[model samples]
Target chain A: MYHLISDIIRQSEENECVFWEIVQQADADERGVSKEESFETMRKMYQAMREADEHYDPKVRSASGMAGGAGQLLHEYNETGENICGDFVGKVMEKAIKMGESNACMHRIVAAPTAGSCGVIPAVFLVAEEMLHLSEDQMVEAMYVSAGIGSVIAENASLAGASGGCQAEIGSASAMAAGGLAYLQGGDAGQIADAAAFALKNMLGLACDPVGGLVEVPCIKRNVAGAVNALTSAQLAMAGIKSAIPADEVIDAMRRIGNEMPSNIKETSLGGLATSPTAQKRIV
Target chain B: MNIFDVVGPVMVGPSSSHTAGAVRIGYIARKLLAEQPRKVQINLYGSFLATGEGHGTKKAIVAGLLGMQTDDERIPMAFELAKQQGVDVSFGEANLKDAHPNTAQLILQGISGQTIEVVGQSVGGSRINIASIDGIETNFSGDYPTLVVHNQDGPGYVSAVSTLLTEQGINIAYMQLYRSNRGGDAVMVAECDQEVPQHVMERLKQVDGIGKVTYLGMMGDE
Candidate 1:
């Protein structure tokens, strides 16, 4: 009986390693592809984003954008008063905030299908496509890559903001975003994994700490950061840089870190923003 | 395991009880009817009634009737989409006794001249509990092979029904028997591991103390 248990444990560890190997080995742009094929893939992603964007309510969109510290910046960009990239960043932030607010209100909204990190993926990919004039298929391919990275994080670490804090929600989102960016930029699968791993590692130990236990407050602002971080990490990986730890190892570390984090720092909102003097004055 | 215990990875948003559960209740209510409802009236109770407007609870119900999931991006525009699909919907509020907070009662008139009253609650994370059908107070969670029998309350009604199930080689996983009074009205709900045979239902309906035997039927994909 003991042998059977030990065998099961060994198999589990081996499976985990194998999963990491698969991620570390994939390359979105490992080899030369026909120009037409590349274009088709880009087109598909753009199409999905557009379709998905239409499903998002304008009210929710506006809310997310405002809350992400992007409302004014986006408005400035719309009027050509801000740099293009800065404006884009602001818009992404705004959308993230709106998503948080909507979730707090218990709105029947689609998460793309993730409510907590809803703003990050769409804001990054959709905005990038518009700015760069990328095709839909390309964007969709990146999204698929992001999904793989997200699954790894979910399996090895946690996606529940309450479990690990905002780090899990926004950090995981950033990792997914980083993978998407690297994949889109023609990086190999290993590079994409490396980028994702690095991005998550950077933001490990961040707290949830949303004010008033609402998905608003820092939640919205963090999503914008998540998007930016994803893009940056992806760029780094495309440049052939690697994270200090492998993707799987980083995920395990995140899990351990989460386990050690105080419960107040998680989504319970008992610490950080929740306990801030200003927040206390407003709610209590 | 109870179906509720199994949380599948659907393409749905977060908060399965709030969003996904509400959609399922609407879907079940639609399926239970003979056809698509021409006119629908929904009454939200307690928390559902209080915050439903903001949560898109109203839209979700309409969307579910129109055959949409909570994860569907088009849930927000469900009202417009429903109109295009020719479904008329209205919403109201009700106070329910001994009911879950996030509960709604729907009165649907199908285009095929059929009508059904559906009362259900969205428990959380998009999960729902169906409370009753057509005034028959039942406790079936829309899982398993459910037998919902609307009958008069009298002696031997339960035993007679149990005997039929035993004879048919079907084991009841759980049973909830509710009635207003001993000699008044009653509803018998049976959750079974296997489907009940047609002959058994017929026998139960013919029993001396039985009034009406209606099988609420099976739920959809888990």
Candidate 2:
């Protein structure tokens, strides 16, 4: 219901709890649905996200035969026990890859802001849940935090690659995940906002150039990177780091950057890696 | 934009606007027809026409016409499923004037020889706008329990429909009326907060000057 992050923060201040304020806003916006019912719906979504990760079959290729097996490869690599990111972050990467690959294969996924960036939020939340021993209710509350941040981004900027760029898609998603992760780690509203701002600020100029006009190459791997970025940004916020710019201003910058982005790179598959020699050779 | 708009829409997709939204357009078309489509011609427009094949928009449309939800895993086999279900499907391109990039015009013929043409636009994030029905301009997103009432252009129809909905205990979330000329045919689209029951639809069809009443229940899951 609140169109701006500043508005959400103000309302949270009034309510004395960011999570409840977001849930109350969601309840009002849904028209007659109570907060509990809204949370129940979110819980179902969380369940679906978890199921998508657990049921991922890396062997299954996409219908276009452009993507598949990469998630399994990542899983195997993580299993070698040589990953420098450690088991927790390695698992986040693994789930992100699985979710992105699943989406390319037309598997059921929750569009955390969008389908192309679906993996980031789920990957981050699932890993946080396991690593921190957070309860399902806590994860659901964290999703409310993510939803509030994402709605602000959607209203102020764009979430579609065609309209903005990968910056809006994956970048907004990483911000959402980062904010949610900060909340899960018991960060205050200011810290959560900082996490989101930091995550988005780092990804401002990212392009959306899916090779072959498919959400396969670069899209899947980009999701993995977004997940890690969310994790790192959350850790930074939890450690009392602040973004030089406010969260709302960072989102405004994202909107301006998205508006100035050339059409060729904004999901046209006509620029960036989409036009690379290797991608060009495989285009036919 | 609600929380679900951000965190959910649980869908099967390579792309939400291309695949999930395309399926929704076809699904809404089928519901408006109120029966299984015997023959359907889908006309893709702009970006949909340029990249729909790779995104499986064609298959998604067929799947939607067959009553498949957005998350249905059978989408890849939509063509085979349509063949098995005896639904004839064809595709082409359309030059829609002043329409969104992701638009599709579906011409469907029901088994009883009833035909309906729907021009719909998938406006990203699996959200859609049903722009026109049977060439008449009207707008309603398939997000609610919608009633599309075609009637003679007059004063009493809106009040009458409103009364009927009130009697049925259904609250109208939004209502819009459009007509070509006075006393000519008019379309009134009413999106209700509650689902319009079949009995209410039957009663609305019997209203004087009301030509056609089509009720599209809440679109099941994204």
Candidate 3:
């Protein structure tokens, strides 16, 4: 029914349906499956994300030997009440890192938009589960919101770091998470679209230069930034802040910037943080 | 973009382009070969050459040749699997003009002694584009039911091939016919909205002036 965020919002308002409901019906129609079946497929994807977290092995190191244990360390820091970001944010950071680390360790992950940015969505889901006590069904509904936002980004811009830089990977994930989090908090479709726009604007032009072309370095840690950006953007939108740029315009700008970006900085690992002295030495 | 495309293709990963997409390229190569791979030569290019090893690109591609899916936990053990499965695999670098950085050219020999050259690129997010097959230029996402026909450049050939699909009630979503030079050699690439069944493909092989007929359906364990 809708491919653009503006269209989706307009459809939601005109039809007097919730954001996820429109997406649910549309996805069902597109996939040629029943609404229940379509929703169940999304539920299964959420289940995989949850299970990935449940199966986290703290001792597991990525093949490059640089990714491991930060999640556990953050968990310990949070338990001691030393985290300055507050409990909910700390929990999200922890979960985000865990998910990113798991992906780097060659474990399975839902590449929400893309794999390097996989942790952002699940971080929001797992943390919201802990702090908000939302039901599994509530969480899955939020995923449709994310998916709607994600599809728009993937279409107008791209979901690949190689094609669109880290902005497309982390920025798209953050925007999706922001929109979904807004939905989770009972925000209207307009608010959801605004939240996504705000989140993506904040992340536009971010580079995708992984050190040694590995996902373990700056790649995994960037997940926290994406998750927190989502959290803050959602909070801002829910509190009545409006994005100056429309969601579609923001996505269009993202595509242009991705095209303008030098390929060396777009996941080729030839520049940016990938070329830092410390990163070079740390490359395994 | 399907929302499902946004949500998943849940896969084994360190890098989607290098690892997961590589697996798909290999799987497509295996499918294009039409039988178990007997021996395969893989030529990695650009970024695939620079960073693919760190991302398990080699192992992932081998796993795919073994008919493994992207999420198969056995991906890391693809080398051992190849040894046991009797698929001789070798990797080398490639220099191709105007190719994507994440490209690989697989020259494969299948168990039935059929050989094919498949060049594919891992665009992103475990999605791949089959850029060419058997050195004939054609483009199709392995996601669709694709028919590639290599034939002599002549009249009635394109009509003949498309007519066969039309007769089978298949809709052609995209169709292209290219010739090396006027009346020299030609290729036809057709991506269908529905599967163009085995019997139709067998019939395609019978068309006059046709040198090769290849079909790619969908990715599955079988």
Write down the worst ten-residue block by lDDT for model 3 chain A.
Answer: A57-66
Candidate 3: give the clashing pairs: none
Cα lDDT tens digits for candidate 1, A104-221 = 4344333432456666777777777776777765675666556556655665677777677777778887887777777667776678778888888889999988665555677656
TM-score of 2: 0.92
Worst 10 residues of 2 chain A by lDDT: A19-28
Best candidate per TM-score, number? 3
Q: How do the residues B26-144 of candidate 2 rate in per-residue lDDT, one tens digit apiece?
A: 89899999898899999999888887877888999889988888888899899999999899999999768978888999999998888889999998789899999878888889888
Question: What value of lDDT does candidate 1 attain over all alpha carbons?
Answer: 0.64
User: What tens digits encode model 2's per-residue C-alpha lDDT throughout A1-284?
Assistant: 57787777777888776754665565566667877778888899999999989889868887667788988988899999989999999999999989999998888899998999999999999989999999999998898889888888988898888878999999999999999999989898889999999999999989999988888989999899999999999999999998999999999999999999999999988899999999989877
The DockQ assigned to candidate 3 is: 0.67
Fraction of true contacts reproduced, model 3?
A: 0.82
RMSD of 1: 8.9
Clashes of 1: 43
Measured against the true two-chain complex, the DockQ scores of the candidates, in the order shown, are 0.13, 0.68, 0.67
lDDT of each: 0.64, 0.89, 0.88
Q: Look at candidate 3 and tell me the lDDT of residue B199.
A: 90
Following a full C-alpha superposition, what root-mean-square deviation does model 3 have from the true structure?
2.3
Can you write out model 3's per-residue Cα lDDT over A1-284, one digit (the tens) per residue? 78798888888888898889888989988889999999899999999999888878889887777889999998899999989999899989999999999888778888897888999999997889778889999999999999999988877898888889989999999999999999888899989999999999999999998889888778889999999999999999999998999899999999999999999998878899899999888875
Q: Each model's fnat?
A: 0.05, 0.79, 0.82
Q: Please give the ranking of all candidate structures by DockQ, highest first, separated by commas.
A: 2, 3, 1
**DockQ winner:** 2
Off by over 4 Å in 3: A79-81, A244-249, A252-263, B181-185
